[model samples]
Target: MTVISVHVPKTGGSSFLDILRKNYGAKLLVDYGLEATTALAAMTSGEHEIVHGHFVADKYVDVQGARYITWLRDPIQRLFSHYQFWQRNKFPRSPFWRQQYYNNFTFEEFAFSPAVRNEQARYLGGMDIKTFSCIGITEFFVESMELFSKSLGMDIELDNLPQHRVNTLSKKGYELDDKGLRAALYEFHSLDYQLYIQGLEVFKSQYSQVSGCLDTRFWDLQKSSQKSFPPQFSLQKLLAEKQVSNVIGTYYYGDGWPINMWDTFRRDVVDEYLDEVRSDGFNTIILLFPMSLFKLKSSNQKAHEIFYNDLVFLLDKIRDKGLNFMFRLGYSWDGFPLSGDRGRVAFSVLCEGSSKDEFIEEARQLYLIAETYSEFLYGFITWEDLLMFPCNRAPKASEPMRIQLATELGFTGNSGAIPERDSGEFLGYLEFLDIKFTDLFMDLAVAFPRLSAEVRVDTTPYNDSDGGEHHYVHHRQFVETDCDVIGTYFATYMLPEKPTLNDMKRILSFVHRQLQVSDPSKKIFIDQLLLVIDESIGKGYSTISEKVIDAFVKWFPEWLDANSIGYATWAFCDYVWDVIFNGTFRYGPLGWEFGGNTMLVESAETRYVQMESGAWLRGGRILHFEPWPQRGCIQIELEVDDACSITVELSDSYTVELDKRDMSQVSSGKRQVITTEFEIVPEYLKILINGGAAKIYRVGLGKEISSCGGRDLNMNHRVTSRLIRELNNNYGGNC
Candidate 1:
């Protein structure tokens, strides 16, 4: 049996390779020459099978009655993912998607013209056309996967499957209109739209019966998996229980991605990694990765690598810089462990299958890889996209997968296997040791509690509250799924004309109430999140409306109330552009969620910190401050130029109907002094340190604009993964 596995970026290739060893053992070819095309020839020489890796076209030719299968995504999303690959590796440079909104308030540029995405598909042999028996639309993956498995007469358990490995920030997210339609039409063209429609057909076929027809177990496991052993008590309870925090104000999905960075560069001008933490509100940052940043890299490949490496170094350096940080861990293709990646290990699945590490040396190899940078490496991870839990084809079971993993550790005795990571049973295993791979991460978290580390790796159950894929389940399962489905319904329907900060807040507010009683792990996650905002929200920036601020703060109000979170809205930078162009982040009353960092609010409720943020007006200008959370606050001073007028408000308008109290303002020479204060609503109100409105002023005289926040959040701009990693490295976090 020739077991071939194609190593795509986010596919489940790793887990499949593990399966090959169980069924093929030594017969599996592990030599590079035996991979891909050479497999057919190699198989003739012996009673053997070839596990595949990175086999694009030629490998599957002329195999009599052989099953040919693969997965695909909407062309637009694929391009974005592919684009990110280059950006992370440094091929093309662009601002992150979100940052563009901050500066331009438009996602039109980053969007795929239907023509481009479809054109790529047409070139890729219509793979995007659902030409295979097991065509999988990643969005409805659970069902597609199950159907594929069944077609091959394989039984996969759904109880423990991982979900949403490949993530794409929707170009058409939120609501839309004629302007939106025309823009998409112009940008995407007919070909891309056709691919999308074809893909939609596949999505509807298998997923209509259930939300995603994924193993319903995902919902259950998502909730049941992590139990902190003996039920952790409190911050007081956790006096004994240990924790972890993974921050990702800046995570690199792939290439010129985050296109927001270019603008962030122009806006924030990120110079160092810690500088990024400063850019994101300091304290600590949890940077995430998948097997995401692979060979091709991004447009700024060298620069991105430098940034990534700088961050690795900065993880430790942050401790020196007097800031906090975290290290996030995740796999490239799905939540699968990259260390066990067969493609990287042996270059192909066949080679990997034939060369099973009798002792699974990969874990040790992983530790070594992680150990290179002793400075930051705060903790392990569950990629942010992992939140999109449960698809129609959610894994059938982890038992088969677990059994394979057990063998990796050389489980000689039938009692040696442990529970599978996702689902299914390692029936032979009875030994439950504390030193499993889980321990590797747990040890790191405990050793660095200051970083408040934790993993949101598993798609805990089908929660109605989460975002992305898991959230999709609620609608698909309840409303209707058909062959014609092609929308993501992001609660945008309830939005108003000209959304305001209050409107954004109301929306996020609904998200808040819906998620009020998060699982213990999520609560812990939020705390560390707040701690992050408290320490560093000062120097970095955001450029959304007061409504954007309201939306952001409302989602994690607890952190705000706890004085552990803050934000910078990049308003100062936007103001400069606004002055130059007569524009503002204010949209609809407050709907200004652009791409990338434009909505820079991740893990806000995932960790703890003591932070405060408020906007002040003096000399007729507005000045807002949001601190990172999980830590306490301190007073600060600044200097300003003469001839500027400013007015400071304690809060943004769309949310938090303030009792409207009056307070006194304080001042200094050119710079004024403001202290973060707690409000009756609990969160610290904005301090009035407004330097007043004035023309652009220069600080740190020679710092590069690219080294600071961009002049504005450019839609195509992105705060590089390099910068993000740098922050983690300095603050003491991930790789």
Candidate 2:
């Protein structure tokens, strides 16, 4: 029974999502609560049997072997509901309200802005959405839900309808007086008011108020088949435990990019030891190649070819072992597969006013790479800012004419261009530049497929009513509450002052939770991705501390889920050679130092991992041995049954009930931490013992977990990100 519901927010769409969850179990779909609207809805297609969530267009509505259904609210009422939602949330710096911290809206000023007036009017008119099959008003939410059930030859009970899916801020945060809020709601929600009136009129002529023609009570059958599911932590543990291997392999490095001149770009030599890369069953590699963006220079430049060739050579070897590759595509900037042409580097500025053709030509060059290489490519990255600005309702299709034009050239645009912005501190003096980047890019997505980017932020540096500066006073309450930079680009809030072991654990956890998906094929991509991050980021910054570095290395399986984020990395050492590299586990002495005899050893790869405050600590060497005869089993303890809880932080997707026990598993003994059981069959493809060095690549844990110290990720070596350096430094270590 495949269920696909194309959800359009506001028209009580969540009511249906809630119902489906109650019946089918919440794990049936990705958890929207832990993610932003973009990532929450990423990769979900309307075509799936029961894939439903704010799917506004048909392109996103396609389902394979499933039902196709949708519900819509009266246009005007939907518009007003949208308006009220913004009003309820008090538009964060919306032009109509206040871009400033104070409630500085002049009634007249609020009444004039396009987001407030024209856009609202378009919404209220119901003129924007025309493709919905069952259109009704919120007043008839129960009936509409009934119609939805009947459309699919089923029955439902409306009693379990979730009240207000979006949990909004408290009254104190909105900063609105009761009276003022009432006024704003009344004025903005006018469409709902009028539409209700009109809908009432229509209902009178169509059917009695409650004639019992349909089963409203039966709708409870739709009570999320998955509500109140088990915690995903168990599944997370299971996954981490299953991804065992002594090697930290690299993906897309070795491409001899000039920027990587400082590290050991030896992924090319990794081919001599596939057994080592496949060590401990955690076989990983970072593909080293580039999109056509810099094809001209990459092909022509000697140094660039050397690095890229090395990366490709690694890929060919990894594939030879019949292993899948997780290809992470870097965007206009952000150096993963280094570019020979510096002009192509990230944060690149394109003409905000470029014509459709110009944008398409360039965009086409990029999009084709993703489309053409979809098979080997496990994830098609939307952006690399890794920095996202948290704001609801990014520029709609009608906006960003130029960027929209770029999308018309054929590529989906995303609203993740800008990173999270704080209320007081500006984005330096580049606010204008940020705006330009978003304005032009989003416009392109509208015209093309979808545009995406990244975001980063920490909830520190804030003020209270008391207004006493408590800079780093060591307050857990403050870390969890006060001074937090809400609306973080990814709603990311780090609690680090300097890189720490806990920070890496936090980031690892964050990425896994946000990247959960229901497909096994997707898991294959995730398995490959882990190998990538270990390489790129791990290799790029090699001078950091061991605690931070080890923590990152120890708990790397955290962020692996996602909404279409593939991964890869650059350079790495020999897998067999590095497995036994960490002989004594010295912070400074650890890491794949330039010249070392990579050998397999039994060790935990020594890094700090978070535990339940009083959880028993079995301190000893955690020997990473091999990938399961199967794929995607993290090197940790996990349960796979009835109701499973799991987190894939890289994609920021979390799930409570994951009974799917086919793909992975883990095991441990008094001292033997070996990964032999796999969620695979035939038992022939598991990781085997081999003598070789490991490789490196860049795969992101679909999350933004932080170090206990809450250090910044951008800086080279605060203990927080020292794991990256440590991994790179000891490019020849093994578990």
Candidate 3:
């Protein structure tokens, strides 16, 4: 069917064009010329689905099966808006009748002009107002579009249609408020007023027939789009049936650090790392594999062979060591040649193209290979890679890729431009990404049976039309996953740099609550429990203190016992490359060295109590502070007993003593923060007790001290090893 959209000026005609274009794509014709009648007469109904332009409705009235649609506004407001728009843009291509007045026209001159008066009626010509298939009201824009779609059967996505206001007037106020001017304008445009009233009546009658239909369909689509895949087996039930204890594990990617471990694979090195992992009291080892490795067309064939052989070798070794393991399928960290591109090309092929089927088939084949080590396999962790788009490029460079992705995800609209972040279309695009991510995890779950999807707990910011910003947390990946377990990483990046013990508790509690609300049936796991993270791998630079590490190690397992199934450290052993470090146990036992006599207490909370006067604990020392220009203040949180003064020393230069006088006077054991600033900050920080006993809880260094708390403190091998050993002894079951 051919549709003629008569675009009356200043009546939302440009916005209507977007809808027409989306519905017709290349089949939509624009006839903005002075003589549209000639073009209308020459065009065939089969050639174009829609002909939209600033033309009269009478032009296509005689065409076979041609229907009409147009938008109308209050004639007084429409004329003033048109005049204001002309004053601003003075569009050179405007109709010849408008060209003479252009920017020189005043509101009174434009409104009283005989040529501009009854302009809407002039566009209608001899055609009856009631003959239009759809007559949209500018005031009721959204509702009009809904009605238009239903009335014309135009295949338009009414819910996701974007508003496209063109040549908008910058004037804040219109002159129609003047009663005298309004009365005179109404009298001058009497013909248009009559036609607008008729069009409105027709619109209301047609809209009433389909009043609640759009809303109902919209809600139905929203409900259907929230697809969930429930796992065949419950993780909690499986753990109990297997008689396995809680998962106490750590991440291992060989000695080459962030690079693919298989590239530097050696039997002796693998054996040594496995031995240390077991000795550290970890019952499980979390291994990482890039999806690109399974892509048949990947250029690194030698790497693929080595990866397969090394994986089998490591799995057999893990079983021999009587340890359980889980595989983390990473989409972002493919390493080496692909690392620069962040595996975007491989991701597009495996997850977004026809090769997705092939990828899944190959994944199934890999699952079959792992079946030989099924006895030692706990599950696979779908690292938060699935939710990511290859967004490493500039927005302009990436827009085409995003558009192609939108098309692949079933967006039928012909909009070539990127949608605004807050637009319904962009949100729909994000929704489609979530659906695709969920579907991919579902496929993996079907193949592996026991799978865990690592969900991102961070919220993304969106700006509203009012220019106010708000955040939206995506829960679809977690809510719709068929994976038996839902996994997430824990790091200070999720909290303030100097978070207190309570702050840590609140953030984790919120994550736990959110996960429960997302899907109450699935069990939760901390796939990467980062006790200490380097600046290279995290959102910001930070250092973790031994006190903080001890506190987390003691509290996290107990908290997990009540809130989740288990957790694994981000890395068990540190891997260094140039200035970058990977794990907490980087300095062996030296990372936990204390400068003075301090008694370590591991009762309810982990802390260091002063054994005698002048006893001090070295919080953390940065040997090369030159690289970190942001380090400025030293902050320490501790409990001071009455009459006991604790001295916080920075690089043995700047010092500040805090006694009970500095306490908030709430309670005797209440934790108080003593922050000391420095002009030339030093690399080392220490806390010393003078004369009496005090409990040191946490210590940190940052650009500035904000409310006194921190994470990413330092810890050595001896400290972490003992902490892990104790956690496993207490939390680990049969494994």
Candidate 4:
């Protein structure tokens, strides 16, 4: 039988032809005729074992004893290699080169050219794909060749075959980094991309069955090949173990999406964004599932299937980028925010008259879906909407309604058995709601013990000093429940402008004290910390300065590690409409403000630096300083302008309760010096200037010895770090 190797350009055709020449010697037919038809005719008259040349498979369909064989490649990579090859071979002396070279084509132009667009599919156009005796991949050349040789009964020596890498870019340079150009190229050759993906699936199916025939030596060659070209099957790098300090992430808020359904199908857009996320040093992404999936009104299984498929696709992409996914299950879609039919069904479970079985089934389905992706799944955050107060007021449910809620939650004995909501036997109605809230979490905790089912609560009136209703009592009751992780939706910008610095300190202290008093061992997670800066809110900057970013990076981690394993920012990327700001009331980059606070720009550049121990914050309106990571003391020399006031506080342990005391304050036009002294080393320090202006001349961490006996007890060992270390020891660490 005569072997017909149809040469698809840039699919290792030339290299395979070289191998054929080596194997067959004089008997190999190497384009003996000037034209394809003439070549077939020449093959008929000769004693040739192989006929190799650039020709379509259809051209030789009628030829007797013709067996077609070819190789394929990843279309995007092939096109890139093709462009680079042409650019390298642009010789002015040759006529073909002179014409093309004078045109000075870009890689984009060459990629979009009609001559080579989807050229492989076009070359094999009319023939059934299975008709070819062996179709191989250029990426996995060794494996493909082994399969090709075995199928065709050819003597291809794996050890001796020359693997020539022609016109290849380095691993990093291989990808099309330009988002716009990459997008244009993908759109232009969308058909080829689909074919390539299909081909990969086919190749994988064939590869597994052919394993019985694969020589032991073939894997040895594969291992060697991987040293340079890397195996095609493994695209993503193995994820590294996350550091205690750098495990920071963001809530990919589905509600903030411009449309209810995002075109996550766009490979170029998603790839670019994921790369940006990886570059930002985040190891986790919390994908908030849209509430449309849970809506009782629409049981569109097709829509569910489509979304699940999309989620799996996005998860694969996320994993390939070496990031873990935390599923935030069942939040309402922004287009139809969980009201009416949807809201009623969800709330009925939490309210008095509802089916406990329906609620359990809902939780069960979410748990099952989560289990399917346990490989990449890190944890889960339960629906946050359950904590909403009607009309933004406390305890809309009356005492009778609260009793009904407790009954629904299966609370035994008397509601009076629980502590009163307030000291005076007044407002005991609110305490009943907390009891129900605890029951809901306890139910989920028992059902999904495998994952750390974190409950994210709203920390409204962040500080008790506001004289408004404080939710700390509710928070204390919730943390005391069986929740695996404690989390809250808090933003520093929510504090009053005058007491911004002091209020932040108080909020953190209250949280720490609650954690210590309840169960210090429980892990905490800041589900959302807004990173925005608005001039209208006295933020006074269009974009954040390195100083502001530095202070946040330096202090936020210390604050988090004191109580929790990690924290996440409010958002990663979002789409905005009309004006950037909705009103004169400018706000920070939290999800609630400016419509969107995308951490990454379209180009994948970050608005802030990745913070760590060695991170620096210098040269801005705020002075540079080293933070007392262990010893929370701070000393500052300030130059206050006329009518300006400055506020400063140290964040240490709960025992200090610095918020209850006021020591340092600076007034206008005077030089003032202040030093903080607490019972223990503080983990964070805050400074805010109000009125005209103020300049921090110098600031630095305190070197004074700790009086609390040792480093703050809260941070002696990180819960996340220990957990990861144990996981790594159990399962081979990386990836």
Q: Residues 1-735, candidate 4, lDDT per residue (tens digit)? A: 778888877888888988787778877877623486777676777777777877777766667877888787767778777778878875566564465567887766677777777787787766766667677777667777777777776688777655354223213335554757655666677666655544543554355455422222322222222222211221012112223333466555331132222311233356776665555456677776543444432444443454556567777777777776675544433222222333434445554333434445555665676666533444443434443432122224566654554344333324422222342322233343454444454445445544443443334433232335654444345555433455654554544443334455576666556555655666666666554432222352123333443344445555664566566655444321101110101111111111111121112221221112212222111111233234444444455545444344333233322122322354545655554554444333444443444444334333431332112223212432333233222222232
Best by TM-score: 3
Whichever of 1 and 4 has more TM-score, that candidate is: 4
TM-score of 3: 0.49
lDDT (CA) per prediction: 0.32, 0.33, 0.59, 0.48
Clashes of 4: 5
Model 2, span 161-277: residue lDDT tens: 544422221111223235454445546645543444333333322322223222222111111111111211222233245442222334433212222211234443444345534
Model 3, position 646, has a per-residue lDDT of 67
* TM-score of every candidate: 0.28, 0.30, 0.49, 0.39
| Order of models, best lDDT first | 3, 4, 2, 1
Tens-place lDDT digits, model 3, residues 659-721: 543443424567666655556545455667786666654454544444322222333646655
* Candidate 4 TM-score to native: 0.39
Error of 4 at 196 (Å): 58
Worst 10 residues of 4 by lDDT: 578-587
* RMSD to true structure for each model, in Å: 26.3, 26.3, 23.9, 27.1
Model 3 Cα displacement at 174 (Å)? 53
What does candidate 1's lDDT look like per residue over 1-735, in tens digits?
333344443334445455445546786654334554466766556566554444553455555444445555544345555545444453223345334434542334445323234443443353434444445555444565566555554555545444443222222423333555544543454554444444444544334333322233222221121221222213222222323232233232111112112111221122344454454443444444333233213323543343355345534454555554333433323211111332232211111132222112322333444455433323333312222211111123255653454344333333333343232222112111111222222333333332222222111233221222231122111111111101111122234434456654564444333332232222323312211111122332223333343344444434433321221111112111210000111111111112111121223121111111222311112112233223222122233334223332323541221112211343223433332322322122222323332221211100112222223233212332233333344433433
